[model samples]
Target: MKAISLFSGGGGMDFAARSLGIDVLFANDVIPETELTFASSFPETDFHLEDIRQISKFPSVDLVTGGYPCQSFSLGGNRNPANDPRTFLFKEFARVVDTVKPKYFVAENVSGLKSIQDGNWLKLQLDTYNEIAGVGYNIATAVVNARDYGVPQRRKRVIIVGVRKDLGVYYHFPKPTHAKPDIAAKKGLLPYASHGEAIRHLPLDVPGEYYERPHDPEGNFSWYYMSRNRKASWLEPSYTIVANFRHTTLHPASPTMKLLWSNLADGWKQKWEFSSEYEHLLHDPTLPVLEKPRRLSWREAALIQTFPEGYEPAGKLEKKFEQIGNAVPPMLMRAILQQIVSGEGLLQFPSEHEQYLTVGKQLSLLSEEQDIEPIES
Candidate 1:
């Protein structure tokens, strides 16, 4: 089936759908840099640089996907999505859904949205979708962790899926594929993948200091790790790639020694040391010391987000991070796409009883692994 992506930051949703063999006929985003990246990577798809509000007509497609701006709804940010003008951007999404009337729609945002003003605000958000789409739309929401789907980072997002009501079948959320900390320890199972596993093998140079002209630019490695220490491993997943670039330093003792040294001399040492000590105090775990505020080359950041290593982003440095940080991780999106295309019906709205059952199962599993009682909130 075909899809159209709105608020398409660097085309994460588009990438996921395409990987699942779904065609993205059109995409729209306001950022010029993102539009450029989308154009370069998705040459076959039409990309428009326009405000979502200005798009009077949305293209007809089987699906619509987007992650509206969440700055207003994010926990770390001001919890003012309802009153912030940016939150109304969802209305534009709804407008497109109403105009295009796609078979399905997926909206993603930060999890803080669920607890906005103790759920009252969330209700209004849902009500808007229901009203705009009408009763035939079967809508469901879930708080999904990317780590549960094999992503190294512990990023949690709220996913809202809406299927045309006439389909009759409810959708269920995708099952978790990675083991939690307790499960890994108790069962002697492999822990969830770490950032190192994702991108360690690439040849490293100075962090964020690109070779003026690569000897084998096209044939050379696309990205490399940039950690605080030289001994840090790359075989695991990565830390969250936050919008604040200063926090992107790799672990100390990362295998990428050259990059670590470069970061240390360039003023990442103090921040890195502080973070390392803080983490040690909290967890008492053995970890290498590293420098902090080490910049991740744009290419590396894209890879951590699961974009192909060579996928060149459009625009300036700041613009690139904005797009990347705002994107849905493609790996997570891929799992969602698999559920939809396989007709797994794995996106169902659970009744209270079903939710209770699921929670019970989860708690039991956690208790078994942690050797402690599970406390329900």
Candidate 2:
């Protein structure tokens, strides 16, 4: 099927849909940096580097997908402030959808969209879609965590799927493949993937520090893992991969690692500087400085979001993170696309090998005994 991606930041949604054999006919974004990356990655696809509101043209396709800007709707933002202009971009998405009339459409946003002032803002947004599309759209909403789709990240986002009313069927969200603490780890199942599992094999190319120097020997693991900290829970998936790298530190031995600060008394700063060894890791001048390199590399962040390795992003490093951080996890997108294509849900399973899930559980149990608090959301 053919597809068009709007607000296509670094084309994460595009990559996922394309990986599932969907033909991405058109990709649009207003940011030049993102457009460059999208163009480089999708050389064959038509890319529009203009505002969706100003675009006078659009392609008819089987699907229209986008994760519209959520700053206004995000909990970290203005708490779904109706006044924020970014929130209105959803209307632009709807406008194009109405004109092009794709068979299916998917919109993604932060989970906070559901809880803003008790969902009053979300209701208005949905009502607007209903009004614009005029009822042929069978809309369903679900909060999806990337880890459920084999992403090593625990990132959660709200996903909305709409099928043309004429299709005569409702779309179901993809099922979770990984086991949670509340659920038993099913063997012979797809073992829950981990942060280490996802990026372990990929070559590490640190920011502004390429592998070209004589002394810069290539290694099998990231410097982040050099401290040999115990792995956290593998079965439950990882926490979100935000733009800030300092938020990436959850390793027990890495005192420079900053856990997410939830409460005022969490002592985040102290924890970030508990040991001289870890403090040095945080101050490593080689690390990227946008948010903090303590989190993850841009490439690592892309992997957590399920972008395949060797995918070259366009623009500067910080721009790359901006595009990557805003992207949809491609693995989750793949599941969504599969459901759309097959008209049925895919089956998930536990693996007979069981080692992958078991090791993760064991490590998580050990960390809990040590009282290692997980990074905050």
Candidate 3:
């Protein structure tokens, strides 16, 4: 099947689609650097460096895959996706769907889209989607956790799959492969991927100031692990990968912050309080055991996002992290594709990949010219 990639940042979704043997007929992103990023990695696709509104037409394809600008729908901002110009960009997505009339369309966005103002915006979004598509389209929506789909990180995204009603098919999301973090396996679910297991091979930096770790400019490694005020374990999945470049998930090396909960004498006023403070350990009665804390490097962040090592991002250091963080975990995307595509017309999904899924340390997806030694186990 062929696809048109919209808002294709660093070609994360595109890469996943290609892995399934889906040809991306056209790729577009507002960020010009993304064109360079996608072209360098996927020379086959026709990369377009322009806004979605500027592109009057796009080649017809079987699938339309991309997550439109998510900042408006995200929780950190003003939470005005309903009225924000960026949120309306989904209409552009619908525009292509209407014109190309693809058999299936997959749209992804931040989970916050489900409810910002009592789910009023979500209702508007679905209504707009159905209106633009006219009739004979069945849209299925779900808020899925990436970790549940086998991703090492605990990222949750709202995915929508629309099938042409003529196909006589109702989309159903596939069951998760991984269970909740630190939870025992129950029936079919497996254990969540932990930070230790995800980047255990990458040698830890020797107490660094900067987040960037030098890896011979050809290899990947862990760099910085800035302290986060949270009590977590290497046994649990990494926190959600946020698009904010300024903030990063804490590493597993550090001790989980200690949480203190107590009830005060005042019944109605200040009745309860809780704290996850590291300061409490500074002057404790005895020495406190703690691992040195650090911030996740760009490579480590990308690895958590489930991108292959060879799938490098271009542009500035901050942009690299932003692209990776904002991207749809390819492994999560692959699982969605398997369910949507089924056995229709000779599928080549990760279910039976000839080589292997984008796991471990090697960049097996790359050609010999860009190949490097796999990270030691």
Candidate 4:
């Protein structure tokens, strides 16, 4: 079966689909900076760099998958649906899907979408899909964590998969190959990939750049992102990687550090002085300052997101980070698509591209964490 991807960000989902040997007829993304990255890996693909809304026609393909913009509905952004024009871009997705009439369609968004406005917006989006063209689609939506599917990061996303009603098929999500929770952890049921486990194989002396920034150099940085949660340990799976690399997860080599900010009558006083370029931070008198020697290099960040080794990205430093941060984490996409495509009898992977698919499939493929070696580049 062939595929046509929309709002494709760095082609993560595209790579996953191709891993299963699903040939992508065409693909489109809004960011021009990502074309080189996608093309570098998939030279045969017809890359379209433009807004999805401008797309009047799309190649007819069996599957359509994309992570429509979720900044507005994301918990990190203003939850106002009226104010965020990007959130409305789903309508364009609907337009293409309805026009092309693919057998299946998949859309990914931030899980916080379910909580915004008491889930009204999420319900509306699904309901709208039901009447796209004639009998529409039977859409199934679920919140999935990437760590549960062999990725090192604990990124949670709301995946919405729609099987065209005319196809008379239903989508079955893949079961978690990786485990979480204390019981599962102790049972040794494919424990979530640890920070160290995610990048232990790579040597610190690699020829590529190794950033030396000071921040969450010990654990995943979620403790500081949203209000700290119980699972806020740095040793656990990493936090959701956003496009902003500067504020991303610090390398695990550094010990855990804290930034103390307290409530004041006016509002709050921040311990990590924002104006100081994060060079000087204030911590509790009891907690000593941890001196971090390096930030997570781009390659390390990509590895944590389960991007295959030797999958050198394109563009400048910030653009490279944007492509990695915005991607769907191909490991997670493969988990879901593997199950879905298996049902469609699309299990045979093409020989030529099999190497690309196998990039990160070693221990991660089995959901078992293990030490890796320096990439054979």
lDDT of each: 0.65, 0.64, 0.67, 0.67
lDDT-based ranking, best first? 4, 3, 1, 2
Which residue pairs collide, candidate 4?
Answer: 201-372, 211-295, 212-294, 212-295, 213-294, 213-295, 219-234
lDDT of 4 by residue, 1-377 (tens): 89988888777898789889999888888787777877888888988888777778778788888888888887778889878888788888888888888888888988777678767676667766776877677665566778877788878887777777666666766656667556456555576777556776666555335433337554333324323321223346877776876566555544434456644445443233112222222222332222443446678778878787788778877777888888899999998788677785122332221111222221122111211111111
Q: For model 1, how big is the CA root-mean-square deviation?
A: 8.8
**Residue by residue across 1-377, what tens digits does model 2's lDDT show?**
99989999888788888888899998888888877787678888999888888996888798999988898877657674768888789988888888888888889988777667766665666666666545467666666667666788877787777777666666766556664433424332355576655655554445451111234442322433333342343223556766543334342122333332334355422212123333323434343222222335677667767888787677666667677778888888888788888877422332221111222232222211111112111
Better model by TM-score, 2 or 4? 4
Candidate 2 residues lying further than 4 Å off, grouped into runs, are: 133-135, 181-189, 202-236, 244-293, 345-377
Q: What is the lDDT of residue 88 in candidate 3?
A: 85
- Least well predicted 10-residue stretch by lDDT in candidate 1: 368-377
Give, for candidate 4, the lowest lDDT window spanning 10 residues. 367-376
> What RMSD does model 4 have?
10.8
Q: Backbone clashes per model, in order?
A: 33, 13, 6, 7
lDDT for 174 (candidate 4):
65
Q: Please write out the lDDT profile of model 3 over residues 1-377, one tens digit for every residue.
A: 99999999977787788888899989999886787788788899898888889888889788898898888878777887656889788888888888888888888988777666655565665666666544546666666778777788877777777777677665666666776534434344577887556866666673432143445442212211222343245656788876655566655554444323323344422211222344424544242333455566677778888888766788776778778888999999988887766644223222221111222211222221210111111
Global Cα lDDT for candidate 1 = 0.65
* Cα-based TM-score, every candidate: 0.75, 0.74, 0.76, 0.77
lDDT of 2: 0.64
lDDT of 1 by residue, 17-40 (tens): 998999999889887787678778
Model 3: runs farther than 4 Å from truth?
133-135, 181-184, 206-231, 255-292, 343-377
